[model samples]
Target chain A: SQQGEEDPQALSIQEGENATMNCSYKTSINNLQWYRQNSGRGLVHLILIRSNEREKHSGRLRVTLDTSKKSSSLLITASRAADTASYFCAPLTQGGSEKLVFGKGTKLTVNP
Target chain B: DAGVTQSPTHLIKTRGQQVTLRCSPKSGHDTVSWYQQALGQGPQFIFQYYEEEERQRGNFPDRFSGHQFPNYSSELNVNALLLGDSALYLCASSLFRGGRYEQYFGPGTRLTVT
Candidate 1:
Protein backbone atom coordinates (compact mmCIF):
# COMPACT_ATOMS: atom_id res chain seq x y z
CA SER A 1 0.00 0.00 0.00
CA GLN A 2 1.10 3.59 -0.67
CA GLN A 3 1.94 5.69 2.35
CA GLY A 4 1.59 9.11 0.76
CA GLU A 5 -1.28 10.75 -1.15
CA GLU A 6 -1.03 13.92 -3.22
CA ASP A 7 -3.92 16.35 -3.50
CA PRO A 8 -5.42 17.93 -6.63
CA GLN A 9 -5.02 15.06 -9.02
CA ALA A 10 -4.63 17.55 -11.86
CA LEU A 11 -3.90 21.25 -12.21
CA SER A 12 -3.88 23.57 -15.22
CA ILE A 13 -2.28 27.00 -15.23
CA GLN A 14 -1.01 29.57 -17.67
CA GLU A 15 2.68 30.05 -18.20
CA GLY A 16 4.40 32.41 -15.74
CA GLU A 17 1.87 31.58 -13.03
CA ASN A 18 2.69 29.68 -9.85
CA ALA A 19 1.75 26.07 -9.29
CA THR A 20 1.40 24.49 -5.90
CA MET A 21 0.83 20.81 -5.07
CA ASN A 22 0.33 19.22 -1.67
CA CYS A 23 1.07 15.77 -0.34
CA SER A 24 0.11 14.00 2.90
CA TYR A 25 1.52 10.84 4.37
CA LYS A 26 0.40 8.46 7.10
CA THR A 27 3.72 7.33 8.60
CA SER A 28 6.83 8.78 10.13
CA ILE A 29 9.58 9.46 7.62
CA ASN A 30 13.25 10.33 7.56
CA ASN A 31 12.89 12.53 4.47
CA LEU A 32 10.48 13.47 1.73
CA GLN A 33 11.53 13.93 -1.88
CA TRP A 34 9.73 15.35 -4.91
CA TYR A 35 10.09 14.31 -8.55
CA ARG A 36 8.87 15.41 -11.97
CA GLN A 37 8.06 13.07 -14.85
CA ASN A 38 7.48 14.08 -18.43
CA SER A 39 5.00 12.12 -20.49
CA GLY A 40 6.24 8.59 -21.20
CA ARG A 41 9.55 9.27 -19.45
CA GLY A 42 11.32 8.59 -16.19
CA LEU A 43 11.32 10.82 -13.12
CA VAL A 44 13.73 13.60 -12.32
CA HIS A 45 14.54 14.39 -8.72
CA LEU A 46 13.43 17.86 -7.71
CA ILE A 47 14.32 18.28 -4.06
CA LEU A 48 14.43 16.55 -0.72
CA ILE A 49 13.59 17.87 2.74
CA ARG A 50 14.61 16.11 5.89
CA SER A 51 12.18 15.64 8.76
CA ASN A 52 13.89 18.35 10.79
CA GLU A 53 13.62 20.93 8.06
CA ARG A 54 10.57 23.09 7.48
CA GLU A 55 11.31 24.67 4.11
CA LYS A 56 13.83 24.52 1.28
CA HIS A 57 14.43 26.32 -1.99
CA SER A 58 16.22 25.62 -5.23
CA GLY A 59 16.02 28.10 -8.09
CA ARG A 60 12.30 28.44 -8.87
CA LEU A 61 11.29 25.45 -6.76
CA ARG A 62 10.24 25.81 -3.14
CA VAL A 63 9.28 22.94 -0.84
CA THR A 64 7.82 23.09 2.63
CA LEU A 65 7.43 20.21 5.00
CA ASP A 66 5.29 20.14 8.15
CA THR A 67 6.22 17.04 10.08
CA SER A 68 3.68 17.81 12.79
CA LYS A 69 0.96 17.75 10.16
CA LYS A 70 2.52 14.92 8.16
CA SER A 71 2.34 16.92 4.99
CA SER A 72 4.48 18.69 2.41
CA SER A 73 3.96 21.12 -0.43
CA LEU A 74 5.83 21.99 -3.62
CA LEU A 75 5.66 25.44 -5.16
CA ILE A 76 6.83 26.06 -8.70
CA THR A 77 7.11 29.76 -9.44
CA ALA A 78 7.06 31.24 -12.91
CA SER A 79 5.84 28.09 -14.47
CA ARG A 80 6.73 27.40 -18.10
CA ALA A 81 5.16 25.17 -20.71
CA ALA A 82 8.17 22.94 -20.22
CA ASP A 83 7.02 22.41 -16.65
CA THR A 84 4.01 20.42 -17.76
CA ALA A 85 4.39 16.96 -16.32
CA SER A 86 3.41 14.68 -13.47
CA TYR A 87 4.73 15.40 -9.99
CA PHE A 88 5.24 12.79 -7.30
CA CYS A 89 6.13 12.83 -3.61
CA ALA A 90 8.08 10.01 -2.04
CA PRO A 91 8.63 9.56 1.67
CA LEU A 92 11.35 7.40 3.11
CA THR A 93 10.61 5.04 5.97
CA GLN A 94 11.89 5.62 9.48
CA GLY A 95 13.80 2.36 9.36
CA GLY A 96 16.30 4.01 7.01
CA SER A 97 15.45 1.60 4.25
CA GLU A 98 16.38 2.41 0.71
CA LYS A 99 12.80 2.07 -0.48
CA LEU A 100 10.61 5.12 -0.96
CA VAL A 101 6.82 4.93 -0.94
CA PHE A 102 5.33 7.26 -3.52
CA GLY A 103 2.03 9.07 -3.82
CA LYS A 104 -0.42 8.88 -6.71
CA GLY A 105 1.02 12.17 -8.08
CA THR A 106 -0.39 15.38 -9.57
CA LYS A 107 -0.53 16.06 -13.31
CA LEU A 108 0.27 19.70 -13.97
CA THR A 109 -0.21 21.48 -17.26
CA VAL A 110 1.32 24.87 -17.93
CA ASN A 111 -0.20 26.40 -21.04
CA PRO A 112 1.67 29.01 -23.02
CA ASP B 1 28.77 10.34 -17.11
CA ALA B 2 25.69 8.49 -18.25
CA GLY B 3 22.68 8.26 -15.96
CA VAL B 4 20.81 5.08 -15.26
CA THR B 5 19.86 3.16 -18.41
CA GLN B 6 17.35 0.39 -19.21
CA SER B 7 17.17 -1.75 -22.30
CA PRO B 8 14.42 -2.76 -24.77
CA THR B 9 12.54 0.53 -24.62
CA HIS B 10 9.24 -1.26 -25.36
CA LEU B 11 8.10 -4.87 -25.36
CA ILE B 12 5.02 -6.93 -26.16
CA LYS B 13 4.32 -10.28 -24.56
CA THR B 14 1.53 -12.80 -24.13
CA ARG B 15 -0.01 -14.07 -20.94
CA GLY B 16 1.84 -16.90 -19.15
CA GLN B 17 5.03 -15.96 -20.93
CA GLN B 18 8.09 -14.59 -19.16
CA VAL B 19 9.97 -11.35 -19.61
CA THR B 20 13.28 -9.98 -18.41
CA LEU B 21 14.10 -6.30 -18.05
CA ARG B 22 17.61 -5.02 -17.48
CA CYS B 23 19.05 -1.95 -15.79
CA SER B 24 22.52 -0.43 -15.52
CA PRO B 25 22.93 1.88 -12.59
CA LYS B 26 24.47 5.31 -12.87
CA SER B 27 28.25 5.48 -12.83
CA GLY B 28 29.78 4.94 -9.36
CA HIS B 29 26.39 4.04 -7.81
CA ASP B 30 26.02 0.73 -5.97
CA THR B 31 22.36 0.16 -5.24
CA VAL B 32 19.52 -0.50 -7.68
CA SER B 33 15.75 -0.62 -7.26
CA TRP B 34 12.84 -1.45 -9.52
CA TYR B 35 9.35 0.05 -9.69
CA GLN B 36 6.09 -0.57 -11.52
CA GLN B 37 3.83 2.26 -12.60
CA ALA B 38 0.39 1.79 -14.01
CA LEU B 39 -1.07 4.22 -16.50
CA GLY B 40 -2.35 6.69 -13.91
CA GLN B 41 -0.79 5.55 -10.67
CA GLY B 42 2.45 6.33 -8.89
CA PRO B 43 5.47 4.09 -9.24
CA GLN B 44 5.30 1.24 -6.72
CA PHE B 45 8.44 -0.26 -5.23
CA ILE B 46 9.19 -3.72 -6.52
CA PHE B 47 12.51 -4.46 -4.82
CA GLN B 48 16.00 -3.26 -4.03
CA TYR B 49 19.38 -4.86 -4.61
CA TYR B 50 22.68 -4.17 -2.89
CA GLU B 51 26.04 -5.94 -2.99
CA GLU B 52 24.69 -8.51 -5.41
CA GLU B 53 21.85 -9.48 -3.09
CA GLU B 54 18.18 -8.76 -2.64
CA ARG B 55 18.26 -6.34 0.24
CA GLN B 56 14.56 -5.53 0.38
CA ARG B 57 11.40 -6.08 -1.59
CA GLY B 58 7.89 -4.69 -1.80
CA ASN B 59 4.63 -6.64 -1.69
CA PHE B 60 5.05 -8.16 -5.13
CA PRO B 61 4.67 -11.91 -5.58
CA ASP B 62 7.36 -14.55 -6.08
CA ARG B 63 6.75 -14.51 -9.81
CA PHE B 64 8.53 -11.17 -9.84
CA SER B 65 12.09 -12.23 -9.15
CA GLY B 66 15.33 -10.31 -9.69
CA HIS B 67 19.10 -10.68 -9.67
CA GLN B 68 21.95 -8.29 -9.11
CA PHE B 69 25.17 -8.91 -10.94
CA PRO B 70 28.71 -8.42 -9.58
CA ASN B 71 28.95 -5.16 -11.51
CA TYR B 72 25.91 -3.76 -9.66
CA SER B 73 23.67 -4.09 -12.71
CA SER B 74 20.31 -5.82 -12.19
CA GLU B 75 17.62 -7.71 -14.02
CA LEU B 76 13.90 -8.03 -13.21
CA ASN B 77 12.18 -11.17 -14.41
CA VAL B 78 8.43 -11.71 -14.30
CA ASN B 79 7.33 -15.28 -14.90
CA ALA B 80 3.86 -16.36 -15.96
CA LEU B 81 2.91 -12.83 -16.88
CA LEU B 82 -0.62 -11.58 -16.24
CA LEU B 83 -2.52 -8.90 -18.10
CA GLY B 84 -2.32 -6.70 -15.05
CA ASP B 85 1.45 -6.94 -15.20
CA SER B 86 1.54 -4.73 -18.25
CA ALA B 87 2.94 -1.43 -17.12
CA LEU B 88 6.01 0.79 -17.20
CA TYR B 89 8.94 -0.79 -15.38
CA LEU B 90 11.37 1.73 -13.97
CA CYS B 91 14.93 1.20 -12.71
CA ALA B 92 16.48 3.53 -10.19
CA SER B 93 20.05 3.82 -8.92
CA SER B 94 21.20 5.11 -5.58
CA LEU B 95 24.60 5.52 -3.97
CA PHE B 96 24.02 3.77 -0.69
CA ARG B 97 21.63 1.60 1.29
CA GLY B 98 20.07 4.43 3.30
CA GLY B 99 17.12 6.67 2.62
CA ARG B 100 19.02 9.94 2.73
CA TYR B 101 20.68 9.18 -0.60
CA GLU B 102 19.19 10.49 -3.80
CA GLN B 103 18.06 8.10 -6.54
CA TYR B 104 18.52 8.51 -10.28
CA PHE B 105 15.93 6.90 -12.53
CA GLY B 106 16.03 5.45 -16.03
CA PRO B 107 13.57 6.15 -18.83
CA GLY B 108 11.89 2.81 -18.12
CA THR B 109 10.64 -0.04 -20.31
CA ARG B 110 7.02 -0.10 -21.37
CA LEU B 111 5.66 -3.64 -21.41
CA THR B 112 2.39 -4.51 -23.05
CA VAL B 113 1.10 -7.94 -22.19
CA THR B 114 -1.59 -9.46 -24.33
Candidate 2:
Protein backbone atom coordinates (compact mmCIF):
# COMPACT_ATOMS: atom_id res chain seq x y z
CA SER A 1 0.00 0.00 0.00
CA GLN A 2 1.11 3.59 -0.66
CA GLN A 3 2.22 5.61 2.34
CA GLY A 4 0.75 8.86 1.10
CA GLU A 5 -2.77 9.45 -0.18
CA GLU A 6 -3.80 12.59 -2.06
CA ASP A 7 -7.28 13.97 -2.31
CA PRO A 8 -9.36 15.19 -5.28
CA GLN A 9 -7.26 13.14 -7.72
CA ALA A 10 -7.85 15.71 -10.45
CA LEU A 11 -8.47 19.44 -10.41
CA SER A 12 -9.15 22.14 -12.97
CA ILE A 13 -8.98 25.87 -12.42
CA GLN A 14 -9.06 28.92 -14.64
CA GLU A 15 -5.96 31.01 -15.10
CA GLY A 16 -5.32 33.41 -12.21
CA GLU A 17 -7.34 31.21 -9.84
CA ASN A 18 -5.80 29.35 -6.94
CA ALA A 19 -5.39 25.59 -6.62
CA THR A 20 -5.13 23.64 -3.41
CA MET A 21 -4.35 19.95 -2.98
CA ASN A 22 -4.30 17.88 0.20
CA CYS A 23 -2.40 14.77 1.31
CA SER A 24 -2.58 12.38 4.21
CA TYR A 25 0.07 9.93 5.30
CA LYS A 26 0.14 6.83 7.47
CA THR A 27 3.46 7.08 9.32
CA SER A 28 5.70 9.60 11.04
CA ILE A 29 8.29 11.33 8.88
CA ASN A 30 11.40 13.42 9.01
CA ASN A 31 10.47 15.77 6.17
CA LEU A 32 7.87 16.25 3.47
CA GLN A 33 8.79 17.24 -0.09
CA TRP A 34 6.62 18.28 -2.98
CA TYR A 35 7.36 17.59 -6.67
CA ARG A 36 5.80 18.64 -9.94
CA GLN A 37 5.73 16.56 -13.13
CA ASN A 38 4.76 17.82 -16.53
CA SER A 39 2.86 15.34 -18.66
CA GLY A 40 4.98 12.24 -19.35
CA ARG A 41 8.10 13.80 -17.91
CA GLY A 42 10.44 13.62 -14.95
CA LEU A 43 9.56 15.30 -11.67
CA VAL A 44 11.08 18.55 -10.51
CA HIS A 45 11.62 19.23 -6.83
CA LEU A 46 9.44 22.08 -5.67
CA ILE A 47 9.78 22.52 -1.90
CA LEU A 48 10.90 20.64 1.16
CA ILE A 49 9.54 21.22 4.68
CA ARG A 50 11.02 19.64 7.75
CA SER A 51 8.75 18.01 10.29
CA ASN A 52 9.58 20.65 12.91
CA GLU A 53 8.25 23.37 10.66
CA ARG A 54 4.60 24.17 10.19
CA GLU A 55 4.60 26.18 6.99
CA LYS A 56 6.89 27.08 4.10
CA HIS A 57 6.65 29.39 1.13
CA SER A 58 8.39 29.53 -2.26
CA GLY A 59 7.20 31.89 -4.90
CA ARG A 60 3.58 31.10 -5.73
CA LEU A 61 3.62 27.87 -3.72
CA ARG A 62 2.76 27.51 -0.04
CA VAL A 63 2.94 24.23 1.87
CA THR A 64 1.58 23.54 5.34
CA LEU A 65 2.38 20.50 7.42
CA ASP A 66 0.44 19.27 10.43
CA THR A 67 2.25 16.37 12.08
CA SER A 68 -0.50 15.77 14.57
CA LYS A 69 -3.01 15.16 11.83
CA LYS A 70 -0.50 13.46 9.55
CA SER A 71 -1.55 15.69 6.72
CA SER A 72 -0.19 18.37 4.37
CA SER A 73 -1.62 20.79 1.87
CA LEU A 74 -0.12 22.54 -1.18
CA LEU A 75 -1.57 25.84 -2.33
CA ILE A 76 -0.67 27.47 -5.65
CA THR A 77 -1.75 31.06 -5.94
CA ALA A 78 -2.29 33.21 -9.03
CA SER A 79 -1.96 30.18 -11.23
CA ARG A 80 -1.19 30.18 -14.94
CA ALA A 81 -1.71 27.67 -17.74
CA ALA A 82 1.93 26.70 -17.58
CA ASP A 83 1.38 25.57 -13.99
CA THR A 84 -0.69 22.66 -15.24
CA ALA A 85 0.95 19.45 -14.04
CA SER A 86 0.81 16.63 -11.52
CA TYR A 87 1.68 17.40 -7.92
CA PHE A 88 2.98 14.73 -5.55
CA CYS A 89 3.84 14.78 -1.87
CA ALA A 90 6.63 12.46 -0.79
CA PRO A 91 7.15 11.88 2.91
CA LEU A 92 10.68 10.87 3.82
CA THR A 93 10.87 8.33 6.60
CA GLN A 94 13.02 8.93 9.66
CA GLY A 95 15.72 6.36 8.97
CA GLY A 96 19.08 5.80 7.38
CA SER A 97 17.56 4.45 4.17
CA GLU A 98 16.05 7.86 3.41
CA LYS A 99 13.11 6.29 1.71
CA LEU A 100 10.92 8.64 -0.36
CA VAL A 101 7.48 7.20 -0.99
CA PHE A 102 5.04 9.01 -3.30
CA GLY A 103 1.27 9.11 -3.66
CA LYS A 104 -0.81 8.74 -6.79
CA GLY A 105 -0.61 12.54 -7.23
CA THR A 106 -3.11 15.31 -7.93
CA LYS A 107 -3.40 16.32 -11.55
CA LEU A 108 -4.03 20.04 -11.95
CA THR A 109 -5.07 21.70 -15.18
CA VAL A 110 -5.08 25.46 -15.32
CA ASN A 111 -7.16 26.61 -18.25
CA PRO A 112 -5.81 29.66 -20.04
CA ASP B 1 26.60 20.68 -13.18
CA ALA B 2 25.27 17.68 -15.01
CA GLY B 3 22.08 16.09 -13.69
CA VAL B 4 21.43 12.37 -13.49
CA THR B 5 21.44 10.68 -16.89
CA GLN B 6 19.98 7.37 -18.06
CA SER B 7 20.89 5.39 -21.17
CA PRO B 8 18.72 3.96 -23.96
CA THR B 9 15.65 6.11 -23.38
CA HIS B 10 13.44 3.27 -24.61
CA LEU B 11 13.77 -0.52 -24.89
CA ILE B 12 11.68 -3.46 -25.98
CA LYS B 13 12.15 -7.03 -24.72
CA THR B 14 10.17 -10.21 -24.84
CA ARG B 15 9.06 -12.11 -21.78
CA GLY B 16 11.75 -14.34 -20.21
CA GLN B 17 14.48 -12.12 -21.69
CA GLN B 18 16.88 -10.00 -19.68
CA VAL B 19 17.68 -6.30 -19.79
CA THR B 20 20.19 -4.00 -18.15
CA LEU B 21 19.59 -0.27 -17.69
CA ARG B 22 22.32 2.15 -16.75
CA CYS B 23 22.44 5.50 -14.98
CA SER B 24 24.99 8.15 -14.18
CA PRO B 25 24.39 10.08 -11.01
CA LYS B 26 24.45 13.83 -10.82
CA SER B 27 27.93 15.27 -10.63
CA GLY B 28 29.33 15.18 -7.07
CA HIS B 29 26.60 12.80 -5.89
CA ASP B 30 27.60 9.46 -4.34
CA THR B 31 24.31 7.75 -3.70
CA VAL B 32 22.03 6.25 -6.33
CA SER B 33 18.49 4.88 -6.16
CA TRP B 34 16.21 3.18 -8.67
CA TYR B 35 12.44 3.25 -9.06
CA GLN B 36 9.78 1.57 -11.17
CA GLN B 37 6.72 3.52 -12.18
CA ALA B 38 3.77 1.85 -13.85
CA LEU B 39 1.33 3.97 -15.71
CA GLY B 40 -1.19 5.99 -13.69
CA GLN B 41 0.72 5.44 -10.43
CA GLY B 42 3.58 6.77 -8.35
CA PRO B 43 7.11 5.40 -8.53
CA GLN B 44 8.00 2.39 -6.40
CA PHE B 45 11.48 2.22 -4.93
CA ILE B 46 13.56 -0.69 -6.24
CA PHE B 47 16.75 -0.26 -4.25
CA GLN B 48 19.58 2.14 -3.44
CA TYR B 49 23.34 1.87 -3.86
CA TYR B 50 26.28 3.70 -2.29
CA GLU B 51 30.02 3.16 -2.15
CA GLU B 52 29.86 0.36 -4.71
CA GLU B 53 27.49 -1.56 -2.48
CA GLU B 54 23.75 -1.87 -2.04
CA ARG B 55 22.54 0.10 0.95
CA GLN B 56 18.83 -0.59 0.79
CA ARG B 57 16.25 -2.56 -1.14
CA GLY B 58 12.51 -2.38 -1.60
CA ASN B 59 9.87 -5.13 -1.88
CA PHE B 60 10.92 -6.20 -5.37
CA PRO B 61 11.88 -9.78 -6.02
CA ASP B 62 15.32 -11.29 -6.60
CA ARG B 63 14.79 -11.07 -10.34
CA PHE B 64 15.28 -7.34 -9.95
CA SER B 65 18.85 -6.59 -8.87
CA GLY B 66 21.38 -3.77 -9.24
CA HIS B 67 25.03 -2.83 -9.06
CA GLN B 68 26.97 0.35 -8.30
CA PHE B 69 30.47 1.10 -9.54
CA PRO B 70 33.32 2.98 -7.86
CA ASN B 71 32.35 6.11 -9.78
CA TYR B 72 28.88 5.94 -8.21
CA SER B 73 27.17 5.16 -11.49
CA SER B 74 24.68 2.25 -11.29
CA GLU B 75 22.93 -0.47 -13.29
CA LEU B 76 19.53 -2.07 -12.82
CA ASN B 77 19.15 -5.61 -14.23
CA VAL B 78 15.88 -7.38 -14.61
CA ASN B 79 16.16 -11.11 -15.28
CA ALA B 80 13.45 -13.40 -16.60
CA LEU B 81 11.29 -10.44 -17.40
CA LEU B 82 7.55 -10.64 -17.12
CA LEU B 83 4.89 -8.57 -18.82
CA GLY B 84 4.35 -6.70 -15.57
CA ASP B 85 8.02 -5.63 -15.60
CA SER B 86 7.26 -3.00 -18.20
CA ALA B 87 7.40 0.49 -16.73
CA LEU B 88 9.31 3.75 -16.61
CA TYR B 89 12.57 3.03 -14.80
CA LEU B 90 13.94 6.06 -12.98
CA CYS B 91 17.32 6.65 -11.39
CA ALA B 92 17.91 9.22 -8.66
CA SER B 93 21.02 10.51 -6.99
CA SER B 94 21.64 12.48 -3.81
CA LEU B 95 24.30 13.45 -1.35
CA PHE B 96 24.02 11.31 1.74
CA ARG B 97 23.93 13.59 4.76
CA GLY B 98 23.21 11.89 8.05
CA GLY B 99 20.98 9.42 6.23
CA ARG B 100 18.81 12.15 4.72
CA TYR B 101 18.76 13.38 1.14
CA GLU B 102 17.11 15.63 -1.39
CA GLN B 103 17.24 13.38 -4.44
CA TYR B 104 17.75 14.48 -8.06
CA PHE B 105 16.02 12.31 -10.64
CA GLY B 106 16.79 11.26 -14.21
CA PRO B 107 14.47 11.37 -17.20
CA GLY B 108 13.98 7.59 -16.90
CA THR B 109 14.11 4.63 -19.33
CA ARG B 110 10.84 3.39 -20.62
CA LEU B 111 10.84 -0.44 -20.97
CA THR B 112 8.29 -2.41 -22.86
CA VAL B 113 7.98 -6.16 -22.20
CA THR B 114 6.32 -8.08 -24.95
Identify the runs in model 1 with alpha carbons over 4 angstroms from their true place: A95-97, B97-100
In candidate 2, what are the lDDT values of residues B12-65, reduced to their tens digit? 999999999999999988999999989989888999998888888899999999
Q: What TM-score, over all chains together, does every model reach?
A: 0.95, 0.95
Q: Model 2: per-residue lDDT, tens digit, A32-107?
A: 8888888767778898888899999999999999999999999999999999999988887763447678878999
Clashing pairs in 1: none
Worst 10 residues of 2 chain B by lDDT: B95-104
Measured with DockQ on alpha carbons, how good is candidate 2?
0.58
lDDT of 1 by residue, B4-101 (tens): 99998999999999999999999988989999999998898999999989988999999999999999999999999999999999999987744446
Deviation in angstroms for A96 in model 2? 5.9
Best by DockQ: 1
i-RMS for every candidate: 2.4, 2.2
